[model samples]
Target: MEAKNPLILTVRLDERSQRFFNEMRIKYFPPERNLLDAHLTLFHQLPDTNETLEIVQNSKRGVFEMGVIKLINLGAGVAYKVDSQELESLRQDLKRAFADRLIPQDKHGFRAHITIQNKTTPEQARLLIAELSESFEPFTIIANGLDLWEYLGGPWKHRGYQSFNYLDK
Candidate 1:
C-alpha cells in the first residue's frame, strides 16, 4: 500500500477572526495538547505533488460569511460550527480538480469549522458548549488566501500561502 501524504490545505481567515478564534482556543483547549492556532480546514490530506500546489495557486479567494454558532459533539470533545456557501463552492471546485488524488476524508462534503476544544471529557465539552452558546452570534470573515502545511505529526510546518485578489470597495 502506498503511504499517505501528510499535507494539509486550509482557508486563511482575516486578522480579526483569527485573533478571536485563537483566544477562544487558548481559553478552552487544553494547553498541553493544543498545537495549532484557529484554522478552517478545506482538505484534511492531499497527495504531495506539484499538481496540488498548482490547484491552490489557481484557486480564487473570496469573502465568506460566518453562519450561526452551534456546538459540535466530537465524541469526547467539542467544536464551534461555521457555515459558508462561498467556502463550499471553493471546496467543490478544488475537489473536482484533485478528485483522483484526494483522500477519503477530503473527498466527502466539506463542513467548515474551527475546533476550540478537543480530547476532553464529554462533560467538559458540554459545559464549554453551554458557556459559549450563551454569547454566540453570527459574523462574517474574509477568506484571504489558501495555506498549505506539512503535517508534522502533531505540529504543522508552514509551507506557503497563495493570497487571493481583494477588491477594495
Candidate 2:
C-alpha cells in the first residue's frame, strides 16, 4: 500500500523550467499523460516526523545548477539526465544526510529523467522515445529551494503533487 500520507520527497525547479516542461507537455505529453514536472527529487519521507524535521533543518543547503539533458528511453519511459558534476555532488550530500530515509540507494548509474508518458507496449514506446530524445536540446537551470511533494497516483493525477513544505538552499 502507498503511504497513508503518501510518499513525500523534496524537489527543486524554477518557474521557467516549469514552463518549458509545460510546453513539452503540449507537443509531447498531453492530458492523461501520466507525466510529472521536472525537478530533482531529494530524499523521501521518514517514518518519524521528529527525526525527519531535525535532519532536514540541520542539513546543509547547497545550490544546484543543472545543464539540460534530454530524456532518453531505456525501454521504460523518458527521463531527464543530469550530467553536471556539481549537481551530482549535491545528490551525494543529500544521500549521506538522509541515509536512513533514502528510498533507493545511491549508485554510480543515475540519470535525471522525468517520465513523460505511459505507453501500452514497449515497442511503441521506443519509437516515441527516439523522436523525443533526438528533438531535445540542452537547457540550464538553477535550484535554490527544496520543495516537498506527495505523489497521489495514476496518470490523471499529475497535478496532485502538493507541496508540503519549502526549504531555501
Model 2 accuracy (lDDT, Cα): 0.55
* Per-residue lDDT of 155 in model 2: 17
Q: Which pairs of residues have clashing backbones in candidate 1?
A: none
Off by over 4 Å in 1: 1-5, 166-169
Candidate 2 residue spans exceeding 4 A from truth = 1-6, 33-36, 60-62, 104-109, 151-169
Residues 100-143, candidate 2: write the lDDT tens digits.
65555333345655455445356756877778767677788766
Tens-place lDDT digits, model 1, residues 99-128: 998888888767778888888899998888
Candidate models: Cα lDDT each: 0.81, 0.55
